[model samples]
Target: MSVQTWTWILVGITFALYFGIAIWARAGSTKEFYVAGGGVSPLANGMATAADWMSAASFISMAGIISFAGYDGSVYLMGWTGGYVLLALLLAPYLRKFGKFTVPDFIGDRYYSNGARTVAVICALIVSFTYVAGQMRGVGIVFSQFLQVEIIWGVVIGMCIVLVFAFLGGMKGITYTQVAQYCVLIFAFMVPAFFISFQMTGDIIPQIGMGGTLEDGTYLLDKLDALHTQLGFKEYTTGSKSTWDVFAITLALMVGTAGLPHVIVRFFTVPKVKDARKSAGYALFLIAILYTTAPAISVFSRTNLIETVSETKYSEIPEWFKNWENTGLIAWTDKNGDGKIQYIAGSAIDGKKPVYTEARGSYGERLIANASAAKNELYVDRDIMVLANPEIAGLPNWVIALVAAGGLAAALSTAAGLLLVISTSISHDLIKKQIRPDISDKSELMWARGSIFVAILIAGYFGINPPGFVAATVALAFGLAAASFFPAIILGIFDKRMNKEGAISGMVVGILLMLFYMMKYKLDMFGGGTQDDWWFGTSPEGFGTVAMIVNVVISLVVSRLTSEPPVEVQEIVENIRIPSGAGEASAH
Candidate 1:
């Protein structure tokens, strides 16, 4: 069957399964809507958590980033992996024991201030929206390529689909849907890796196949390194980022992962503190399956990409290349009028992306609207590597279609989780806890569903116009979370003296500083400086670590100068730290 036919078949079947789960597990009350009734089995919650943790960023963009950035891209892998560990070990058990429906709920009760809760709600909204934009963008990328639709329309379609399950079942529906999604996405990701691995090096395991020699008896990494040298790029295995920058980026990603609200809320679904710990353990092993395989896929795809297209004539390029070019993610210009692609170092066009002309080039290729003078004649978006890998490897049509389904599963699962956070923050944190403490369960549930609908609309717009690459956008969201929430949560739990004043002040300052730096560097808002203007040589992605430190310092100083937290709040903190059981987790 054709790839498109198979894509429809697989996507239809998987989406049907998701919709079925949503129907079977629809929430009947606010409790079910918020934390799956806080009674989910540890294993099921773990699978759901694993699915929620691995978003489109992990499934689609992480390997793509690693493939292009080479050794420098290890920051994403290291930072995210370490960040998950940080969340699981350092935060999950305590928060679960605290028995809050959401992170902001925990903050409100722990800090003994509705104002503090409001600030945390704002932070969660910002981070969740920013993160969901990337997932929406990933959905658009998959649909635009395989479903043969414009990116904007793809995002719209995705928004409708997410709204169905989210509005119907809320957290209950999302959790079980994610469990099924985990199965689909993991299968989708691993199958392609196995196929390409065996095809390339006669090894079934991509991890081993990456290190295995080619049919010509050449080491794969060695050949890729030689390709780098030939193309005037740095060695594939060598680091390009400065030492401090690498550290900064890695640390930022780690803390950012820990601070992410959607991931944090996963622990609350389990029945007990011990169950939360067990859930974390199960999630770690489940998550490791893909995390370990990503780099191998990166190596295989990068090597395949170069060998297939480098110096190849535009007219003779394969169907996959043209299909992608039509989507405007890949572009080739006859810079030297040689009618062949020159994939090499440096930007290929005026900026990073190519502007399109309404006309085709001499070789029937898309014409660049603002072509650059650089010698490099190819422009390939890093986000496309994973999606295009199977096609690039000439794999079977069913495998190619499965990847599309898997990419959607990864994207939609996380998107549902994020939208739920946004919904719960408004409905539970903002409305029920603050404005209308006496509101009925039915009204709150209505408010939650209404909020999800609005959130999906906003997320769809951002998907149509994302700030940067999918992974890059997600990293900025992490920075926002780290700068805002990580300090408050850590200090509130570990420091008996962390009053509301300190927590609120630290959160306000940290997030604003992060926004300023991100806009100045990433969005080019504040004078739009270059890499040379980075504070202490840290990139925007790594600036979160700096902002987090500043938050910590400010939090400590403010807390020491201010009056201590109320005796009751301190008692609440001490109670959360007690690992005995859920006996006193209900203390206020």
Candidate 2:
């Protein structure tokens, strides 16, 4: 069967299964819509949490970034994975004991002010929107290649699919669906790694194969380093980023992971604090399977890409190149009229991405309007590396099709989780909790469903016009989370005197600082400046660490100067940490 045929078959089956789960597990009340009725077992919650946490950033773009950025990209791996551990051990169980349905709920009730809840809601929307944009873009990228559609239409399609599940079953539907998604995405991610590993190094374990040698006894990493030097790029194993920037990015990702509202919300689904800890453990174990495999896949892809396409004739380029080229994710220009692709380190185009012209060159390669004056002549979107890896290696069509399914599963699962957070923030925190406290569960559920519809449309638009690639965009979302939420939640739980004034002031300042920095560097807004002008040598991606520190400092200073939290509020904080009388057998 053709790859497209297999893709249709596999995607069709997965979609059907998702739809079936959504119907069977549809939420009947606001509780189920928000946290799966608080009845989920540890194993199921762990699977769902892993699926929720591992968005398109993990499945599609993380390896792609590592493949291109080489050692510098390890920050993402360390930051995100470490951030999960921080959340699991440092925050998850405590937040679960706090027994809030959403981050805004915790912030509102803990701060003893509706104002604090409002600020948290805004932060949640910002972080979740930014994160969902990446998932949407990932969805668009996968569909554009395998289903052969434009990115915009692919995004629209993804929005529709997510709407069906989110609207019908809310968190209950999303949870069960995510468990299935975890299974599909993991299987899909591993199959190609196994195939490429055995084919390249006579080893089936990608982790082992990455270190193993080729037929000529050349160590794989050594060969890649040699290839990179041959083409004037940094050696694959050498670090180019400064130590501070690396540390900054890692810290931002770690705390940002801890601060993320959607992931925090996952612990609320379990029945007890113990169950939350257990689920976090299970999720870490499941997530490790992919996290460890990614670096190996990165090595395999970087080596395969350099060997397969470097200086190759355009007319004779592999089928995968043309297939992705047709989607505009892969483009090559005949610079110097050589009719061969120059896949080197420098910028291939004047801009970050290719601006393709309707016309084709003499060699039939796509013509880009903004081709750089430099000798480089190829542009490959980093998000496509994982999806293209299977095709690049000429894996079986079934394996390739399965990857397409996995990519969508990874993307859609996270998208649903983010959308749910957005919906809950608006419907529960803003509308029901603040404006209409008297509203019944039925009306709140309606509003929640309504919000998802609007959120999906907006999310699709951002996906169609993302600020950056999948993983980069997600990193910024982490920065937002770190900047705004981490301080408030930590101080709220650990410090009894932390007041609403301090928490609100800190969130506003941190998020605004992050937005200003991101816009100035990433979008050239706020009087845009060059990379050299970054504050304290931090990249926009890593600036979250600075923002987070500022947030914490400001929060502490303001709290000391302001009136202390109410007696009841202080007691709530003290009780969550008591550890005993946690009602281990009772559901929230």
Candidate 3:
């Protein structure tokens, strides 16, 4: 079968399975919609949480970023996985014991103030919306490539699919659907890795293959480092980022991962506090399966791409190159008219007009020139590395199609989970909790469904015109979460003296500071300046680490000045710390 035919078949089958699961596990009550009836088994919840957490960034773009960034990319592998440890050890069990429907519920009750809940709701929406945008973009990328549709239409299609499951089944439906998605996506991701690993290193395990010697008897990392240096790029093992920046980015990502509202909400679905802890362990194990392999996949794909395309004649370029070129992700300008593509690194020369290159004539000949007059002639979009990996490795069509299905499954499952959070925060936390505490459950469910549709539309818009590459955009969302929610949640659990004044103020300032930095650097707001203008050389992506520290400091100072949390709230915290009787304690 052709690529398109196989893609249709595989994607169709996966969607059918998801739809069936959604129908089978359709939510019938507010409890089901919000927490899957709060009776999900640990193993099942773990798989669902893994799917909910991975998103399109992990499935489609993480390896792509690592392929290009080399060792700098290890931050993501360490940051995301390490954060799960924090979740399991510090937050998940306690939150499960505190056990309400959402992250906002804990903040509201713990702080004894509706204002705190409102602030938490806003933070959740911002974090969830930002994260969902990237997932939608991932969906669009897959659709544009496989379905041969415009990115806008692709996003619309994705939105519809998510709506079908999220609106109908809510968390109940989403959980089961995610379990299925996890299976499909993990299998799809691993098959390609196994194939590439065996072909490159004669080893079947991707992790081992990455470290093993290549067919040419050269160490894989040694060859990759040599290739990078020969092209004036940083070594594959030693990255270019300053030590401080790497530490900050990694820390921010770890904290952010634990703070993500959607991820935290997953703990609410399990039956007991111990179950939540076990679920976190299961989740980390499942997630590590991909996280560990990502770096290996990155090494393989990067090496494969360099060998296959660099210095090759433009006319003799592989079919995969042409296919990607049509997507406008791969481009070249033959500045010297050498008729060969140059993929080396080069420094930018000031005052040089960028001679934009375009493909021309029957042979699709194109000039290759760097926009900044850099040594490299080709600009390969980082987002395409994972999606195009199978094609580049000369895999069979069915495997490629399975990858497409996997990417979509990754994207749609996370999208559903995020949209549910956004809708739940608005309908349950904002409306039902603050505005109409006496609202009927049916009415609240209707509001939740309505909010989801609106949220999906907004998410789709951002997806069609993403702010950055998938992983980078997602990193910013993590930054926001880390800055705003992590501090408050952590302090709420550990410090019985933490007051509404402290938690609310800390969340507001932290999120606002993060938003200011991101907007200034990423969105070019406020007469934007370059990285040189960044404070202490902290890039916008890593600035969250600084902001999180500021939040902690400010919360501590403010809490000391303000009256402590009420005695009842302190008792509630004490109760949550105990493991036994958690099921009964949480019921209240």
Candidate 4:
């Protein structure tokens, strides 16, 4: 069967299964909508959390980013996975013990201030919306390639499917559906990885295969390093980012991961505090399976890409090349009219204009080249590497189709989770808690569903008419979370004297600082600056670390100046720290 046929079949089946789960697990009450009725098992919650955490960035983009960034990409692996440890040890169980349906609920009640809750809700909306834009884009990308539909239509379709599950089933439906999504996505990701590993190194394990000796009896890393040098790129095993930047970026991502409201809200769904702890561990384990394999896949794909495309004649390039090129993800210009493609590091060549000048097929069967003169004549979108891997390696069409489904699963699962957080914060925190405390449960549920519908539409709009700001919004989202929520939540739990004044002030300052820095550098706002202008050589991505530190310090200083929290609030903190009687504590 054609790839499209297989893609439609696999994607259709997964969609049907998700819709069925939604129907079977439709939410009945506000509790079900918000926290799955607090009956989720640890293991199921863990898998669902894994699915929720791994977005399009993980599924479609991480390996590709690693493939190009090489060792610098380790920050992503370490930062993301390390945050789970923080979540498990520092926040998850305590928050679960607090027994709230959402993160804002805890923040509001802990501070005994509706203002704090409103701030938390705003942060949640910002982070969730920024993150969901990327997921929607991932959906559009996959649909554009696999289903041969326009990207806008693909996003619309994705928004509709998500609305069906998220609007109807709420957290209960999302949880069970995520369990299935985890299975499908993991299988789809690992199958091609295993096949490619064996094909490259005669080993079934991608981790070992990356380090193992190849058929030529040379170590894979050694060969990759040599190829990298030959092409004028950095060695695959080494990185070019400064040590401080790496450390800061890693720290920011770690704290940001723990701070993200969507991931934190997952802990609230479990039945017990112990389940939340166990679920965090399970989530880490499941996430590690993919995280550990990504670097290996990165090495394999980079090596495969170089070997397959380097010095190949443009006309004779692989069928996959042409296919992706038509999607505008892969492009080549025949510099020097050589009719041969050059795949080398961009830095290796200077002052050589590409021979293909026209926007149309002036390049003769290829789109106009957007890539400047480089060692290579081709520009391959980093996002397409993983999706194109199977075809590049001549894998079966079904495996390719499976990848499409997996990409959607990852994107949609995370999107659903973020959208839920957005909806819940508005409906439960802003409306029910602050605006209309007397609202009925049915009315709250209705508002939640309505919010989901509106959020999806807004997210879809961003996906279709994505602003320039949306490009780096994912990292910025992490930065915002790190600067705002991580400090507030951690201090709230660990410090009894931290009052609402301190928490709210810190979050506002932290998020604003991070946002200002990101806007200045990323969007060239505030009179336009370059990396050279960054404070202490910290790029926008790493500036969150500085902002987080400032948040902590400011929070501590402000809290010392302000009156201590009420006696009830202090007791609330002490009670959450203890595991004994946790079930009873949550019963309140």
| Model 1: lowest-lDDT 10 consecutive positions | 579-588
Per-residue lDDT of candidate 1, residues 83-138 (tens digit): 99999999988888777889899889988999999999999999999999999999
Q: What would the per-residue lDDT of candidate 2 be over residues 275-377, giving only the tens digit for each residue?
A: 9989999999999999999999999988889889998888888888888888888888877777788888788888767888888778777789998888888
Deviation of model 4 at 96, angstroms: 0.6
Candidate 1 RMSD to the correct structure: 1.4
How much lDDT does each candidate structure score?
A: 0.91, 0.93, 0.88, 0.85
Summarize candidate 3's per-residue lDDT along 1-588 as a digit string, tens digits: 898899889988989999999999999999999999988999999999999988899999999999998889888888888888888898988888887889998889899999999999999999988899999989888887786655677788888888898999999999999999999999999999999999989999999999999877999999999999998888989878889999999999999988998988899998777788788899989999998899988999899899898899889998888776665566766655687878888632222222335547344753334455566677777777888999999999999999999999999999999999999999999999989989999999999999999999999999877778889999999999999999999999888889999998899999999999999988888888798898889988898999999999999999999898889999988878887777666642
Estimate, for each residue in 115-141, the C-alpha lDDT of model 4 and write its tens digit: 999999998888788788888878877
C-alpha RMSD of each candidate structure in angstroms: 1.4, 1.0, 2.4, 2.7
Please name the candidate that would achieve the greatest TM-score relative to the true structure: 2
Candidate 3 Cα outliers beyond 4 Å, as residue runs: 346-362, 365-372
Largest lDDT belongs to which candidate?
2
In lDDT terms, how accurate is model 3?
A: 0.88
> What's the TM-score of each model vs. the native?
0.98, 0.99, 0.96, 0.95
Off by over 4 Å in 4: 347-364, 369-375, 464-473
Backbone clashes for every candidate come to: 0, 0, 7, 1
Cα miss at 365, model 1 (Å)?
1.2
